[model samples]
Structure formats: structure tokens, C-alpha cells
Target: MTGPVVVGVDGSSACMAAAWWAAREAVDRHAPLHLVHSWTSQPLDVPISQDAHSERLYGREVLRRTEAELLHRHGDLAVTTDLVAAPAAQALLARGGDAELLVLGSRGHGSVAGFLLGSTALRVVGLTRCPAVVVRADDPTVGAGRDRLVAADRDEVVVGVPEPGPAAEALLEFAFATADAHGDLLRAVTVVPGSPGPRAEEERRAWLAAELAPWREKYPKVTVAERVAVGPAAQLLLTSCGRSRLLIVGRRPHPSHLVWKLGPVAHAAVRHAACPVAVVPHG
Candidate 1:
């Protein structure tokens, strides 16, 4: 929780947008902003003459340009840059182990494209030890001329509360902490399958309230809104993203030996959500 906010940059427009988002987040959390650019040699089949050297040089330039832009926007913010010789996901996971939050960019054109066919961004989010946020290059909330303070006050933080147990505590904790920091409203939502009767809806509401009780007490200043709906979890959550500044979802930890995959809801969120999506790993 005390480490700097780390973001991966690959000299793409999407990564640059994510870097900007990470800069504002770092400032809000009073943490340093670390820019990581990872590059590796060309494949064995391809000609390797001077390719590795050129890639390294390009990586450094990308980091330098990103660092300068962030510092220009946030004059007093502490910023650092790193050029690593590794795959993007590997480099990010290594640096993000001690970070408070890991931010990455998604180049997917739409939900159908879905993280551009599950590339580095998806891999990093699935395996990251710390919370990971996936931001799109075209996200409306992140750009020049958008006042950070005003946006914080106007937008809400939407969190998907799937169940009431220790597993959900981490998700709720992040949501409440974020809303508290920004002085924004926290919208906690849970979805039930198909249509339910009044009694079922009431029970679901009670469950959601119980899950959020401790967090509400912990962050009394943060306003809370509970929403229980009947439909697909991913669908409902995606709809909520339109009015939200940040969407938080939970990812159950998977074994290291197994192929990493995000849950349906979290997968949809990171890939399709209109706003920035934070995938927090929980037990």
C-alpha cells in the first residue's frame, strides 16, 4: 500500500493514456509514479542484427518522453523511469510486486476485441499480486482539459460485490479507500440470475448491506449506495461503468502452475468497461 504506482509503457497511444491516468492516481495517493518500459531481442527466426540495440534505445526514449510529460502535468509529483530487458508482463509483475497499484493500457477496439486478443494487459492483470488497473486510450475521463478535482467530485466509484465473506473484503476495502480518498460516492452492486421475487430481492439487498457494513463504518465520510439487480453480472456492471470514474472488481487467485484466467465478470470489466477498471486479487 505504501509503494509507488507502477505503469507499463510500450510507446503506444494506449499506454501513454494509461500513464497519464497513473500520474493522477499517484498524486491522489501521494505515491511516486514509476514508468516501466520492457523490451527484448527479436525472435530467433528473425534477423537480430542491431535489433536489440535499437529496441533498447527506443524503450529509453519512450520512458523519457513519458516521464517528462507526467512531470510537466504534475509539477511536484515524484516520478521515476525504468528500462527492463524482459517481456512486458514479466517486467510489470516484477516491478508491481511492491507497488500500491499497477496500471496498464488496453488497445482493444471494443468489447468484442477484448484486450486485443488477451495480450500483455490481460496477462498482467490476471497474475499481478497487487491491484491492477486497465485503462483504454479513448477513455473519456482521462485526457487534457478534464479537471481532476472536478472529476473526482462528480464521478462515482463502482464496485461489484459478489458475495459476503472474507474473499470480498479486499474488493470492498479498495473501493471504500478509493472513494474516501476522492470524496466520491461508492456504488456497491450485486447481480442475481434471472428474475427474482420480492423476497429474493430483499434477501439479496440484505446480503449486500451486510457485506458493506464494516466498510461503511470504517469510512464514515464516504457516501454508499447499494444496488441489487437481476441479470448477468458482467452486463449490469458494464452498464454502471458509464457514470463511474473507476470500476473495481475481484479476481480469485489461481495456482502458479495453471494457466491464468480472469473470472467472467472481471474479464468483462477489464476488457469492456467504459472507464478505468481495477482488478483486485482476493482469496
Candidate 2:
């Protein structure tokens, strides 16, 4: 919470949606908002309909309009803009390093308009130490969470706990804090080994209960539902998220290579879930 909430902005409606979501989050956290747009110029003398200059101009316009709109929406919120001449991933990673949260918009398949969750978002989310939230551009519940952050209509926050390890600490803390902030129900789901014997099932349940007991006591006001599912981790999580407004998952920051970024379940949730996904990085 020390640094401002930063959002990556391109001209795409998806980035706009991300900016709006980031703005609301900034307001909620009482942090400043930074809008970043990164671009690299085309080769000099390249023949094109819309050249680098035009693209730069358009980027500038995007920033201006987005800044204005955010200000209009939240007059008292501190909003700033930047147009960087760099790759989107590098710019976002650098900016997000010192940010409270980094928000980016995801477009599936890149067929329709809007910024797709191309390499840039995936890279930034994978490498950044800060918490990142990927908001789908086509999400129907676009600004609903912002409208009622404390009391959203669908007030269930679902988090997937893969196993008993130190990595889960950050993810669980984020889930609990989010649920507490919104005064929502917290649903923690863990996938037990399929067809476990009764003793193993009891042990798994006990471990889960013990794992969450500290958080439960700390957040006494938070209503929690602990679910132990036996199936493929991703499928069970996706099914459990039917009534959830937000899905929280954890990913370790791996080498910048594409293959090392998201774990299987987190990747699946980010790719297929209808709700927004908050990917918390844990070492």
C-alpha cells in the first residue's frame, strides 16, 4: 500500500476497463493512480497508413482521455499518466515493482477488439513482485465491484489453496484481506488427492482447518467456508467459482521464460473463469 496503484493503458477498451478498475482500487486503498502506456516506434521511413507519429499521438490522446475520465469519475483521486517508449511488459514490470497493485485487462483470442492477454500482460504478471489482477475486457460485471466494493451483490471471494506450503501464505492473506475489505464471505478451496482413503481425507481436512485457524481468528468477523474438493484442481476450482465474484490464485515468480510463469490451475482459472482473477505472487 505504500506506492500508487498502477494500470497499463493502451487504446483498447480492455486497457480502459483496467484503468477504470485500477482507479477504483486506488480510491479504495487511498492510493494514487498511475496510467502507463508503453510503445515502441516503427522503423524510420516505414510506409504505413498509421505511422509511429500517429500511434504516439493516439497514445497521448488515450492517456489524456483516460485521465480525464478517471478524474471525472473520482474527482478527489490522484491520477497520473505516462507514455513510455518501451515494450509493454518491461514498462509495466518496472512500474509495477513499486506499485501497490498492478491491474491489466485481458482479451481472449485477440479476435475481437481490445488488448489481448498477449505476452506483455503474461510477462508482467509473471515477473512482478506486486500483486496483479487481470480484468477481462468483456466482463459483464465491469464496474459493479467498484460501485459497491464493501457490499458487492455477489460477495463471495474464492481462493484456491494448492497444497500445504509457504507459498500459500501470501495467497491466503490476500484472500482474507480482500474478503475483510469487502465484508464478503471467504471460500477457501483445496483439492485433495483423488480417491483418498478416509484417514487421509480426515488428515487433509484437519490440515486445512489448522492452516486456516490463525486467519479465522484474526478475521473473526469474516465468514469463511472451507471446501475440500476431490477432482482435478482446476476443474473443481472453476466449478466452485460459479457464485464467486473474485477468484484469487497464487503464482511464483519464475524466470522470465514463458513456460515458467503460471501454474496449471492458476493459468486455467485466469484463462477460463468469468470473474476477474487476482494472481498473487509467492516465493
Candidate 3:
């Protein structure tokens, strides 16, 4: 069994939505749910007596009440809570490495430029060893049967292919697992990193064909379809999101160090995808 599903909750409306989202995922995966909250020990710039330690204590109480309320409301779910001693962002990043999925609520806490580029979401997006799902307070709907590449039949699972790396296994595993569960086809998609050179591209396609053979045969319920295109990963993914019920992606490495930064394509898709996206780590 996997570790608990993690969600950052602060009692806000957006946080509530994030909790609901995480809860649904936890139920689907048959995993425990972990609701986390954090606060700093520093005092406010104003002449405030509330130090960071006091604030954390208050935060802990709030978390306790919140968890109790959640458990009561979702009696059927197995819910747990954690009150940690770090800022929300840092604590989330630290815990993200162990959880199956990390989710956050967007309260417009970052800059306008950052929001346009999805910056605040990018912070943990790159660093997390698991996929992080960010839900906007204003977002009214969540999508399902959403695929980046979906088959025509109803019983097909859609898998997303971000830049292949440590997390490639997540997409492959999710696709097959879903197929195995529902007796559906498994669709895989990869955004061509720019238009490929003809010969080089052909070689990659051959490689992909070879890679798929074992999977298709092993999971006979998993029929396969592939999509390759160029432009941006996020945009392509968003397009794919329109077609499939679920999208699978790799966990972002770290935001600051990578050239492409936080896997913008994955970021855009997760924030805006029509279907629920599972950002799984390769492990």
C-alpha cells in the first residue's frame, strides 16, 4: 500500500475544495488522507505579541478542530491530520517527497506575473518528488474522463508523458493500473520537444514502439494510442486533458535548478486540466 495522500489545508474556501479533492483521490486509491497545516514562529511586522511559537500552537489547535470536523463529515474516509513547524510552502515541500500526491489551495498569495505564469504553484511543482495538484478558489468544476490521449471506447485509460525521466514509471504504471482496474485501453502521449529532426525522430519512434510492445502484450486490456506534437508541454497536455478521464505525470524535480524551470506544461495542465491529474513519482 502507498503512504497517505497529502493535502495542505488552512480552513479557507479554497483549502476546503483542495481537501475535498484530496479526499476523493484518497478514497479512489484506498489510501489514508493526511491534512497538513503549518505556521511560522516569527511575529508580524506590526507590534504584535504573537510569536511564531504561539502562532504554531494556535495553528495546531486549528488543525485538530479541522481534522475532527473532517472526520465527522467524511465518516467513511480514513482521515489524519498533521501540524508541523514550518511555513506552509516549505513544510509541504518537505512532506511531498513521501506522499503519493501533494495538493495546495491557491489564494492569490503570489504576484500577478507569477499567477500568469503559475509561479506560486511552480514553487513546489518542481521540487516535489510527487505530483502536486493546485486548485483555484474560483475554479467551479473538476473534470473526469479527461485524457490527454483517450481512446474511443469508454473503457480506456489516458496517460500523460512529460519529459521522460525519474517519473516516467508513474505514467506507465497509472495507465496500466487504470486499465487493469476497469478493463480499458491505455493511451500514452508525449509532446515532441520541438519538431524533431526526421532521422532522429524516426529513431525515437522506433524506440517508443519497442518500449510499448511488452506493455501492450502484458496488459491485454490496455489497448494503446500515442500522440506526438510540438509547441508547449502544458498546452498539449491541456488538449489531452480534454479527451481523457485521468492524466498521469511525473513529479517535478526542483524549481530553481532546472533550465525549463518547473515543467510549465505539467503545471498548466494540472491547474487547468479538465480531468483529474495524478502527478506520480517514478519510484
Candidate 4:
């Protein structure tokens, strides 16, 4: 990872917030920091295209200047810039490959996701190569509200099948840490595909209880619940994730799998969860 903090920037106020947070994080982690920006080529020969194209170029230049200033401000830190020809989420995931962690502004350049957890953040959180931190948009004074971290990282025991794969472990660890640190409630949630058969629901419920039982010592106060309903994971989770301090999920084993990439549960959590969502890498 070259021991550097990697942050994705889109020249948005949110991105800058992420960059600022990343600077502090790099200092804390004693690692270098890199600021990344992305832009695609505009349509060929269109009116005002020059202005639009030039704007991204300016953004890149500004990023360079800021990178230098950040390094200068931090006595022993290093900062660099990356310009890429991909979407913000894709670039961040790729860049995250060489980072201890990835920092992101909870909100994106445009289109807020209920709060700042818009689609980009959601997609990237579960897919990033490393654990991701979504800096809250409000930046409310630390130790605000419930001041709790909800850990929802775990395999969704599929009745007879194991929780998707090894990915759940990373997610659970992030959740456990946050909960332990923030003194927040650790709400472990899993979705069970809707089954009309009462027998199937009963079996799934039993399995969830047993799975969560072993983690009691780890989370003395974690509340466990399962939603056995129809529809995709994302929609169900979005509807159920109420007041969670941080909705946690893990990277599925097969990052390239289309279903895992756009899983209903993870997508919904990223898109609509009120609080920040942490995408934990495979621990």
C-alpha cells in the first residue's frame, strides 16, 4: 500500500471535506496521502464543451496545488495527485488497492442520498479494496447524539447455507470496533428471503439466533434481528435500517459477480441509510 492515505475528490465541497479528513487521518496513521480526481471526455465537438472540459482540467490543477500544500503543512507527510478516466467510485476502488484505508465524503457532488450516502458512496463502500470511511457531511461535533456505532457485519446465515462467504468477517469486525469505540448499539441485521412456508421461516429464525449467540461476549449489547421477506436485499435493508449510527456491510467474496456487486441489501443500505455506511474489506 506504500503506506499512504487515499481519498477520492470530485472538486465538490464534500470531496474537499474528505480530503481534509484524509489529511488528518494520514497524520494519525503516519502514512502518506493521495488525492484522486476523475473526469470523462465530453461529447465530441459540442457547444460550451471547451468550458466543461477545461473545468475538470482546472480541478486537476487545483488538486495538485492542494496536494503540495497539504504535504507542506504536515512536516513528515507525503501527498500526491491522481487523474483518472473512470467514475469516482471505480477509480477510488482501484486506487484503494494500495492503501491502508480509503476516505470518502459521505455526500457526493450532486444528488444526496437521503443524507450524504448517495449511490456512489454505497457502490464503493462494499467494493473498495480496503476499509472505507465516509466522513459525515454535517461533521457534527464529535460525541453527538447517541454517540454509538452499530455493527451489522456478519454472514446472513442462509438457513442451510453459510453467510455468502468470508466477506462477512471484515464487516463484523468494523462494526464491532465502531460499537466498542463509540459506545453505540451494535444492531446486527440479516435478510432472509421470503418464504411462504412457515417451516422455512422458523428454521431461518432459529439459525439467526444461534449464529448471533456466539458473539454476545464480543458485543454485550448488540441487538440481533432478521427480516424474512421478499424483494432485494437493498430495498429491505433500506427500509429497516432506522437510526443506525453506521450501517456496516462486507465485500462479497466475488467482487466481479453481478449479483454481489448490486446486491439488494447492500445497495439499499448505501443508498438510503440515514447515517454513514462503512464498507469493510475482506478482513
lDDT of candidates 1 onward, in order:
0.79, 0.75, 0.60, 0.56
Candidate maximizing TM-score: 1
Rate residue 113 of model 2 by lDDT. 23
Tens-digit lDDT track for model 3 on 71-174? Answer: 65557888877787766667777888778778766543331111112454466666676666665544334322122122343344566665544456556766
For model 3, the stretches where C-alpha displacement exceeds 4 angstroms are 41-74, 107-121, 138-158, 162-167, 178-186, 192-209, 216-225, 243-246, 251-260, 275-283
Q: How do the predictions measure up, each by TM-score?
A: 0.89, 0.86, 0.68, 0.56
The lDDT, on a scale of 0 to 1, for candidate 2 is 0.75
Ranking of predictions according to TM-score: 1, 2, 3, 4
Among residues 3 or more apart in sequence or in different chains, the pairs in candidate 2 whose N, CA or C atoms overlap within 3 Å are: none
- Where in model 1 is the C-alpha error above 4 Å? 41-49, 111-117, 145-154, 193-195
lDDT of 3 at 4: 78
lDDT of 1 by residue, 1-283 (tens): 5799998876676777788889888988889999887766222222345677887887788888888888878999999888888776778788878999999876644531111224546777888889999887777667643354234433799999877665579999999999988778899989764569888899888888888888899999999988899888999998876678899999987778245688998888876787889999888
Position 20, candidate 1: lDDT: 86
Could you give the C-alpha RMSD of every candidate to the true structure, in order shown?
3.6, 3.9, 6.4, 7.7
Worst 10 residues of 1 by lDDT: 111-120
Rank order by lDDT, top first?
1, 2, 3, 4
Deviation from truth (RMSD, Å), model 2: 3.9
Per-residue lDDT tens digits for candidate 2, residues 189-218, read: 987775777787787888889989999988
